[model samples]
Target: MGTPFSFDDGTAICLYVINRAPLVEINDEALALHHLSGMGLDPWNPRRMTALRERIHPFGVTLCNNGALSLLTQETQLGWHVPRFISAELAVAQWAREQMGGTEESRNLAEEVEMYLRAWRPHADLIRHPRQRGISGHEHQFDFLQNDELIDVITPHHNATGGLMRKLVDVLNAGDESAPKVRVIVDDRTDPARAGIEMQIIASLAKAMPLSKLLDRVHSGSA
Candidate 1:
């Protein structure tokens, strides 16, 4: 499917995925109490944070020295999911359909989407700026970038940096010639022994072609 909106000028969306934990091992098998209780709003409560942490101690939490130690629910409140999608227009339309329902909401949602796109049009320069970065929660990083066009997604995976980089590289590889380059930052600075897995993945890529060459092709202007 084609993007719903089009821009005569060059407008790009830069999605920045910050690695709060530049160095840490994530216990993916861990399950938080919120997951069991279905505490949608529990994250906002300070008491809940402490209590939840205590509850998950047994399962072991995902540790990221550079990242914050908090429930995933708490991170969503920071508005990090905004830049996840590539197409803002389509995102709004989809959200409108789901949240508002009915024709009136749909119409209103369309107007709002247009308004958002209109406002974003002027700020395209800022959004597309090389340094202009938008921060999002780590948990939502992959989900948000699954589909987007207006903005380029940035995901820095510290725990499994190589796995994350490989997945992102695969996406760019599958993208059309016109797809904007997606940057996946892998923090290789870690204990040599522990960093072996991630380095191994990078090493494999380097074998076929220089790391710089692979990155250049994905980020090439000709793309």
Candidate 2:
């Protein structure tokens, strides 16, 4: 539980020392590139380690042969050929951040649905998030999947609604003989323009069901 090291610009970078090897954890690409540039090395130049010493000097760290830097200690010798390693770490961290963000957003959307369902369809046995399945192999996940029903919860955002609509179309046309019944629940409190577009898309799809309406249907056991 070492105190994290962070840059002055409000971005936190977690550093862990394992077997005397300092590991840097940076989430944002811009922040990683900024730190890389601060070390006087081009972020994209993975083959050059001309500024390795200068980079480690500012943080009082020593670089190891395996490209792990030593934090707050100069016991380890600096390695000259660690540009590729740093670049790889940054790339992987940035990718992981992006993936984590998507997962978090999906989880938030599912939570919203769960809250509504708890109050309305308290006894309904439904899966919160379910894997996508169809002959199309589109890999489109749903917010809720209960029995033969596939429900997608979308924000009032135009892009979010549009994306859900595309997924619905894919599921409908997936050529699967047993495609589940598709449903969409839109948040009523969305930006007016985006909500209008969402409503229009729902009208066109002929399957737009509001959250309240869906709750009623579920409570009435007609869903």
Give the TM-scores of the predictions, in the order they appear: 0.21, 0.48
Per-residue lDDT tens digits for candidate 2, residues 7-49, read 3222355444334346343222233443433222233344333
RMSD of each: 19.5, 11.9
User: Alpha carbon lDDT of residue 79, candidate 2?
Assistant: 39
Residue ranges of candidate 1 with Cα displaced over 4 Å: 1-159, 162-166, 178-183, 203-223
Residue 203 lDDT, candidate 1, scale 0-100: 44
How does residue 189 of candidate 1 score in lDDT? Answer: 30
Residue 117 displacement (Å), model 1: 27
Which of the numbered candidates is closest to the native, going by highest lDDT? 2
- CA-lDDT, candidates in order: 0.30, 0.50
Best by TM-score: 2
lDDT of 1: 0.30
